[model samples]
Target: MVGRADDAVWRPYEDGGSLGWMGTQGGTIARDEDFGGLARLTYELDDSRSFHALSCSVTGWLLYHRFFDNAAAASAAFEEMKPALEALLTQLPEGGPSVPGNARLGGPILAAFTVRYG
Candidate 1:
């Protein structure tokens, strides 16, 4: 259910290491799918195509941002996916949030994922 397209960028957590983990590996943009409601170009740690994303608060904050190996695709993908991803957030469950071990949603959610070469 998870793979890559022909286009993906390869940017790391470099150019300006933030904290201890800044220089560490960023992550693979398995898909341009959306899982969480991160506004700053973020995605779930796993299962971008599903609501079964598992991550603690800390990990969730580090959601991956998908990029493209090509500039044209990059802009297009970002533009197209941003609104779609943001809209998903508005459809979250009415309750507070999922428990310790549960899918983010009670049903399946259609999401798009983007990724880089890394």
Candidate 2:
């Protein structure tokens, strides 16, 4: 899962990685709850919920980037779910990244998303 998440971020394809193919796997949850994970903001700002924005950004990236792979399918998925996530992002307030106690993990991890599409 960590590798998959990393691939989704860095997209180090030369290293045998991918941003992964995001599609409706199966079941309602996959489309609903499971995919919800993709939209959960991976960041936080002093308990302010950066993860919500991160989720929207990542899901949007997946929807837009992978559209060519299956245009109709991708569009359908995006239509079924992009609005609410977008609304969540709009509601989020910006703040400085919350630092944790440990030096290594002190900085924000999922506070923001870096997306790439080819």
Candidate 3:
């Protein structure tokens, strides 16, 4: 699915936000009224060399928190990203395009962690 999305140039963050655009595609800015007031967005590099950049970034934060006695906060952060993670899991399965990283398991872990800790 991720490969298909990549092929189709599917972008989760068409609008400028906390999330950065990935892959070979050019960057674009979009607006979501629902998130307009609450979110502050910043972008550095538009394309991510690794296919699982977002997943790795979030997981890296979680891991850091886990090692820093901030697991609770990390769990909370995962809760916020749970929806997209789950969606990614549902959209991609084993041997699927999104199997680029630990996303296959990360998605389920995010979902379970959200339910358990959130």
Rank list by TM-score? 1, 2, 3
RMSD of each: 12.9, 15.1, 14.9
Q: Estimate each model's TM-score.
A: 0.37, 0.23, 0.21
| Tens digits of per-residue lDDT for model 1, 24-89 | 124333223222323333222222322211111111212443434444555455556555444544
**lDDT: which is higher, 2 or 3?**
3
Score candidate 2 by TM-score against the native: 0.23
Query: Where does candidate 3 stray beyond 4 Å?
Result: 1-68, 90-118
lDDT of 2 by residue, 83-116 (tens): 5444433333332123333223312233232222
Task: For residue 43, give model 3's deviation from the true position in Å.
Answer: 29
Better of 2 and 3 by TM-score: 2
Off by over 4 Å in 2: 1-68, 96-118
Q: Model 3 shows how many backbone clashes?
A: 1
- Steric clashes per prediction: 12, 8, 1
Considering summed lDDT, which 10 consecutive residues are worst modelled in model 1?
A: 52-61
